[model samples]
Target: MGMIRFALAMAVLLSHLPLTNVKFIGGGLAVQAFFVVSGFYMALVLNGKYTDRGLFYTNRLLRIYPAYFVMMAIAAVFLFGFKASGTATLGMFEQAYTNPVTAIILGFEHILLVGQDILFWMKIEPDGDLVFDLANAPPAEDKPWAWQALLVPQSWSLSIELMFYAVAPFLARLNWRWLVALAAASIALRLSGYWLSIDLGLWQARFFPTALFLFIFGMLAHKALPLAMRLPAWTGWAATAAALTLIIFLPLAGLPDGAVRWITYVAIAAAAPFAFHVTRNLTADRWIGELSYPLYLTHLPFIGVVLTYEPPMPVLCAIAGSIALAILLFVLVDRPVDRWRQARAAGKAGPASTMAAATP
Candidate 1:
């Protein structure tokens, strides 16, 4: 599962790289897979270990903030520095930040927007196009209600996940029937929204309800894990292969962007949890998983910096620097914090902790 996560993060990174002929896989699909994985783990831990709300919130804060703040702080420095030197105009800066610390201080909204799947209002880019409009250009006057881009654009996905963590305890408690119904409802709503031609402003593709099914699949996977394990390991490999095939080949087949395309994404997401279940307890896999978050969080920012230099080996520099930074953060920040979290949880639970953990 960890290895799978690392691969998904890499797929996203590859998709972003300013290289030719490299985007064979969809990074967005990988992110969808991430939500599913998160759904499984959050449900597993919240249900088993942090049933208490205060403790659960504390753990989530510790898990997300320490590292997130570090990244945001670095972003602020760059943004402020560029502004102070008059290298960039104050207008965009003002739109992105109220003050240097405001984004970090009031990050709760970003977390909540994740639940709604709304990041800020969609704005027109300087390039005279809407963000994420890979092919088409929009009318110049069209803009978002409000937009925030002081930090790396990729941070939006994490905000969505944080939103999920906020309500995961309750979500995890729902019966299988309800979970499935909710998942179906999420998809149906998005499809209906599309069918009706409702124009959701900027990053409309990111609407929370549209993607909630992936996470629900993850929760359902946890419920089905015991049965999944009972199956032959080859089944896991087959599911994984099918998912990778869909992610890589479907777009190349040049299917029109409609129901078929969307269904392909849904099916790929559906296959991921089963693939995740069978790949248990390998040290190599765990190490990759541990590195995945760091890799995902840091890559785009590093690339942003690297792009400024216009280096001949831009991709090489970005990948290397991102990997080095990820390794350093994992060692100094992520690993230590995780150990402390485990230690504290253990001390609080005493002998009963193992029994609780054993169930997951």
Candidate 2:
């Protein structure tokens, strides 16, 4: 999850850059990587059965929201309170920051886990004529809400994730043929969804399939990777490494662009070795992975505050502050809620039960 979260934060950051004009790499692909990574981790984490859906979602909710809301509040404070600069001009920097009604609304989206589903505040670039009277200008000429540029942009991916979560258990319980069919159908649907998103003027449509595809891949891996997990560490690492090398060498050109979306399917397939190697080492190294959800929900607004008004402060300062905020969130918000949920889950366990991990 931490890996997913970090990738998510990276995705949002990369997504907003001018790099879309670049040919070889695009931020959108970063988010797609995140979806696959997310799918992989979810399958790994939720492989076990549970009798309580309520507890399951509750734990998930608790694990995600506390740090999320805290970051929102901090973002609100900084957006409002910080000086625009030593320069003398009153602007949205302070006014927007102080009132923070917009920030609050955006924050609410994450708290409600509905950030990605918001279709009303469409990206201004794509909807300029419909949304506003701006005319005779290309979509490129318009600037959307600054909020859209942050990690908030990928909240839509989270919604896709929730949909996957809804179906994951059913996927988990299926046999190989069933899983294989599910994957084939889902791959078809996923591509159709992306094409529809591109053609239907829905950016999020392009978004959901990325996550959905990754998730299906993750389910497949969960089914297949156990054999490798059963191998010795050296063998596991070697196999994992070989898989990764194959990924770099895979003929995955036109991956997102080509109808051969299955190329990434194979790349992630080959990359399974690296995935295995990392996951084995990850359970014990729980800090960032554990803090990932909080970091995901919180990091952007915190960044917004730092970069708000395009401050004259050095970029390093903003980076430093953001790191500090991430640490603080893990300490003050994420850890406590995870602890609370684990305790509650423990107390509610049945007589024969040993334990349940309230995974984020």
Candidate 3:
């Protein structure tokens, strides 16, 4: 599971590189794949560890926000100190700041991370009006896409993750049949975009409602955990290998883009439990898995910096620098916070501590 998570994060990094002709599992698919993983983990924790929703919510906040703020600060330094005024984030910030109301709203979204996903569905007019625009297309000359205002633009996915966290406890309580029905409905909504004249690229990819099915698929994978545990141990390794192969080599298999995506999704949903079952007890594997979150959060800033400075082999430099920063963040930030999170979950700290560790 850790290896797969790491690979998925790398896939996102590679996909974002300036190389125009390269093809692999892209940032979009990798993010959706992560939703599946998040669903499985959330289901696991809600069922096994959390008896109290408040603890669950607080612990999740602890897990996300600390590292997030660190990256946000880094982005700010680049935006102001380095005079990255030409960047979309800086431009968006400057334009939005001209209107006091827009500045306040966007500022809160940046700080709180609750409504960042809505930025994808909106645009900022030249006059600073934040208008709803479902098309999510590039705006007229001088108008900027609303998402450009995001300092950490990719944090939109974090907003989606937060939404899932908000609903996951109740979703975990549903019977398998009910869960299946809800997932089916979500999938129907996702696939209905073509006929409904919605832009599938933005809506299906970014919209919480349509993306719910991917997470549900992961929850369904969790429901299959018992079956996974009962299977021969070799099955776990085999499942992990198969999933890796699909993610890495599927593009070379000559399939249609859409078909490749569904195949990868289904493959990940089916394989995740087995992968976790195999890797759950390995200390090194868990540590590697821990890097994925910080890596995902920190990579874009490094990429932006390297691309701005035009270092030799900027892509490779960005990837290496991001990984190094992820290691530092994992060690300096995540490790200590995780100890506290674990203690709180284990009821070691106080009455607020009511749950147990769900994963290492």
Off by over 4 Å in 1: 79-91, 94-119, 122-148, 195-204, 241-250, 258-274, 347-360
Highest lDDT against the true fold, candidate:
3
- Model 1, 1-360: lDDT tens digits are 665677678878878777645654567766876787788777667656764677777877777767766766665665565432112234554533544343443355444334223434344344323233322234243332223443545666776777777778889889999999998998787667545534643233566667677788788877766666678888787877776666556667776756434565556445544666565545566777788888887777677666665667878887888888888878888888887877666655633354234211
Clash count list over all predictions: 1, 6, 1
Poorest stretch of ten by lDDT in candidate 2: 127-136
lDDT tens digits by residue: candidate 2, 280-311: 44664346556445545554454555445564
Model 3 ranges off by over 4 Å: 20-23, 84-89, 348-360
lDDT values of the candidates?
A: 0.63, 0.49, 0.82
* Model 1 quality (TM-score): 0.78
Model 1: per-residue Cα lDDT at residue 5:
73
What TM-score against the true fold does each predicted structure earn?
A: 0.78, 0.68, 0.93
Candidate 2 yields a Cα-based lDDT of 0.49
Report the lDDT tens digits of candidate 3 across residue range 260-350.
8899889999999999988887778888889999988878778777777788877678789889999999999988999888877776233
lDDT score at residue 345, model 2, on the 0-100 scale: 65
